[model samples]
Target: MLPINRAVSRGLFAGLALKAGSSTDVAWARACYAIRFQSTSTHLTDASNRIRRRRKKPAFLDRTPFPPSPEEAVNNILYNTPNATPAPVTRHVLNCLVSNEPGVLSHVSGILAGRGFNIESLVVAKTEVPDLSRMTIVLNGQNVVIEQAKKQLEDMVPVWAVLDYTHGRIVERELLLAKVSTVPHEHLSEFVEHEIEGQEVEEPESRTSFSPLLGTALQRQAITELARLFGARVVDVSLDGVILELSAKPDRVDAFLKLLKPYGIVEAARSGAMAMPRSPVDGVFEDEASLEVEDDSGKVDATMLPPG
Candidate 1:
């Protein structure tokens, strides 16, 4: 039997010849058919070579062994890859004391947003002073940019003070509440009560014997112990889960959550970071050198300005 390609070519050329109306056209079709068959083997050879080239291993791969060393394998995988190191940006915490009025939060957030500054966490609430509110904002940015942002915040109409507490000695804390699952593993089987001759028989406790209720109790105990270790309180408990509350520094809170993950955390919520300067002297601003008003008589009244 003729090859499929050759058979199709012969049929195609025969059709062309039959369709030719003139003798010259028929002769031209015959010559074209001869040329096509003559070049078929060369074209097939070139296509086969192309396929083999594509199937061959890349030049870099050929230099490495079948099972490359760990380091070399990693290098090969990451060859010509871009550096994955992140930009140098540090978290900055700013505490702004602003007027307690409507649109204050919106105005403050808008200023940050307009400048392309992302507020990672913002906690705003009424301050000790009745007319003032404190906004604790956490964001990541370069030091210079954060400093400029602080200046802008201080210049706002409603803002009374802007404190950059990122580098200062301050007490920072975050609150976390997590619900952890208390369900026991399915593999634990409860003790089975059997009957023999109408008499109730209980299976004796053994290595294989495990009660789901007991397992659940043990799991709760473990959770309680972990909470105690992390200084977390068991706020609420249910048949299926228990809620834990923790107030600690951000890192400590993260560590506690990491340890609680084994107990199957169902849900979690965090109150963003709240911070205050550790020293009373830190927040106080220096008094201006000149507070006296200049008058035609050059009379100075020290009482005009309040005592610093």
Candidate 2:
């Protein structure tokens, strides 16, 4: 079959479209024309021939070889914490830009699954345009495995870019939504008054006494007030409790939960860290600190992270 270049293929299709009203019809005529007229086999065959005839991979002066895998020294032990033994494995986050098409995620995940790397957390969402998406993937692995994974990801067609934000100084944040309890509108003021600590009270009046249901209401009221102080927004309310949502640094939010321990916590959910590099100003870094494992060699050691 003869090969059809872009100009010839488009010209041929244009002629077929003009004859759509004919008895043969567009679909049938188009299929016949495609089978008989438009061909790319010869062009592909020539390209394959050129590739086979090439002697060796081209070399450029600036080409840098991929880093070789390193072997551990006899006393290469590092500590994750001051007293902790046997440092934990490192985790890396890859931000992937991909075409918004079906099976793209499956293909990306399949590669990770095959490599035996554990995915700590993954968030996939569409971008400003419907035809593109960003996949933020967190995975645990050795340095060698991490580099190899990046190389493989770059080779896939659907993947447009894979930027690693693991070792860099990055800004990361997470979201938390909690279902907390609160008192009904009626007993709010009394519930609020009793929560104040060291309030010496004499024998109470009849109205001061709280019933069984009111006791639960008091507990819920304390919880709600605490949530409010943490800048949490009330999302939903019911006869029992309210659903509150908040966004904060992960560690600070963890501390907030510890403060809520006095009140009964019903439910909570958290998202994995969403991270990006801090903006640079005049070629200087605005954010300076980075989390690192302290090592004698002053190299990148696995800084153990608390499990999600």
Candidate 3:
């Protein structure tokens, strides 16, 4: 028993001594090396896993209503007009000839604001005759909402005429004024070269003229011709002028200016479009001048329009 107990004690003590030594410098060195090695391996594994997960996840645009396929994403921006369906933002211009009464303008504007039509711009000026005034208003909304707004304006007592300039065969124009920054060689050349981005030229020509594209009775033919011959772009076409914001090549726009030299150019500005539909009836408003409104409740009256 004594021998056995001694053997057990010796073994236990030796094991303890070994364990104690292991916890000191030698054990500490091994422990540190093991931890460092494991840490490096763990980090590398974690990084590889993260890369794989990222590769599997979809892009930000994939969550949209209409996700662009591989082909669409490559060719067009994900948020381009064609890719993104536009909400119903129908634009309209309204031309009115109202009696120059004190509260007439207020009533017209109030009707629009009350019904929640977003008026982009409103201009009111007295006509050549002191008793009458001309008002131009731009607004946007749903087609139904606009129709309701128009009906409300026409129903008002003082409104002589409320013409939806959108359809009228009249000259319409919107002015754009932009004070773009110009620092020497900074963005000046880029800014000077292009204000709006979408421009492509077919052929180069030498020309410098600012001719207002005339919107005459035969303007459709002229526009078609111009588009065919010079590859002129029709930015917008209204009764007034066919807005040709040259998107062709730089040399092409320059050549267009040369071709337009013989024709006179009107005002030019930088920005999006602001146009009004104009008609040749501007000079012959005598019959329209004498138009008398007979209010037929709950119905649109056409006797108010300018006669040709």
The prediction achieving the highest lDDT against the true structure is 1
Q: Per-residue lDDT of 47-139 in model 1, one digit per residue for the tens?
A: 999999889675654555478799998998799688887657999999999999999899889888877888878999997889999999999
Among all windows of 10 consecutive residues in model 1, the one with the lowest summed lDDT is 187-196
For model 2 the TM-score comes to 0.52
Ranking by TM-score: 1, 2, 3
TM-scores, one per candidate = 0.56, 0.52, 0.34
User: Is candidate 1 or 3 superior in TM-score?
Assistant: 1
Q: Please, what are the lDDT tens digits per residue for candidate 3 over residues 1-308?
A: 23434444544554555567755455544544445555557668999999998886665675457776989887675456475555677777778878888998788888888988767777787889998988888778877777888888788777788777675554444433211111222333443344356442222243452112222324445444655586545566543345555444334545665554333344444322234453435564434544522233446668987887
Candidate 1 residue spans exceeding 4 A from truth: 1-87, 185-207, 280-308
Error of 3 at 21 (Å): 86
Clashing residue pairs in all predictions, respectively, total 0, 0, 20
Task: Please list the C-alpha lDDT of all candidates, in the order they appear.
Answer: 0.79, 0.72, 0.58
lDDT-sorted candidate list, best first: 1, 2, 3
* TM value for model 3: 0.34
